[model samples]
Target: MTSRASRSGRWMERLNGEIEWHPSQAVTTMTDQAHSVASKLEQLLKAVANNPSLERQLKMATTASAICEVASSAGIELRPADVVKHYANRLLSASDEVSVQNFDLCSWDAGELLWAMKQWT
Candidate 1:
């Protein structure tokens, strides 16, 4: 009886040890996907800024799409025109108008805040 109990305990321990434990793979995958999307968005924004035609069309397309995604993530539903208006208003706020550095800085700060919030919460 003692040997039988000991053998059963060993088997149980082996079974438990063989089992793998991970909190949530889905959460990890989602975070990875979000990071990939953000990286691609930044790359696209840079591409748009480097060329006038790309900039115009991207402003009319990619920029609006990206803003929509951001707005959706932030629980806001905004039109492209509204975004453009807000952007124009920001442009007006600058005494010397706007520069590419300002554009990069804006997105960089936004991304920083976003990642920070994710980490904090």
Candidate 2:
């Protein structure tokens, strides 16, 4: 009878140990998944930060000194965030024909600015 009780106690201990191990393993797997998700989010943020539309905005706003001054005053150094801000500023200031012409010159989709570049040459 004593041996049987001892064997039963040992089996229960082993089962508890196995159960504990699984939770720890699950915790580790969850941690790894969270790290992977965080890394992907960082990469996405960087890609958005380096978007090309921002560069196009800087190029268009810098087409004229007046526009460049406005862009510079807005603290946009041709970087992604600055490009967005500069574009927004230009759109807000787009009341006059000069502003409209400059905005068109800086259009991101169409290669219209190349015409101005050719004329400059």
Candidate 3:
């Protein structure tokens, strides 16, 4: 039997793939929204990168609540899970072990974090 984590990972992969290939107008809208949310998340990550205090806060945060508090203090309006969902592909592509923990942001390496902030051109 597949573990819960394995099943969730598969579900996310399928959902993300469907978001790309499904040809319905509603799907298109959802894709656009996901991109927009990702862009905002990228901006937020960049902002964190440039601010030592914010970067420290994020790096030291061990719980989702702490991360959300830090993000809120930094003026990021989205919840951590929203950002994770929007940037799921980039994060997963960076590392196979990079799964979201308890619907919260997982710790990311500097390179993967920077990659997430890179704007789509």
Best-matching candidate per lDDT: 3
**Sliding window of 10 residues with minimal summed lDDT for model 2:** 74-83
Task: Pull out the clashing pairs in model 1.
Answer: none
lDDT of each: 0.61, 0.55, 0.70
The number of residue pairs in model 1 that clash at the backbone is 0
In candidate 3 the C-alpha lDDT for residue 19 amounts to 83
**lDDT for each residue of candidate 2 in 3-67, tens digit (9 for 90 to 100):** 98899999999899878466678878756755554454344335445766534554455444533
Q: RMSD, model 1, all Cα superposed?
A: 13.0
Give the Å error, residue 100, model 3. 13
lDDT of 3 by residue, 32-59 (tens): 8777767665776888889999889888
For every candidate, C-alpha RMSD to the true structure in Å: 13.0, 18.0, 15.8
Q: Write the per-residue lDDT of candidate 1 for residues 8-61, one digit (tens) a residue.
A: 999989987987854587778756755554555565556556667656554554
Output the lDDT of residue 16, model 3. 82
Whose TM-score is greatest here?
A: 3
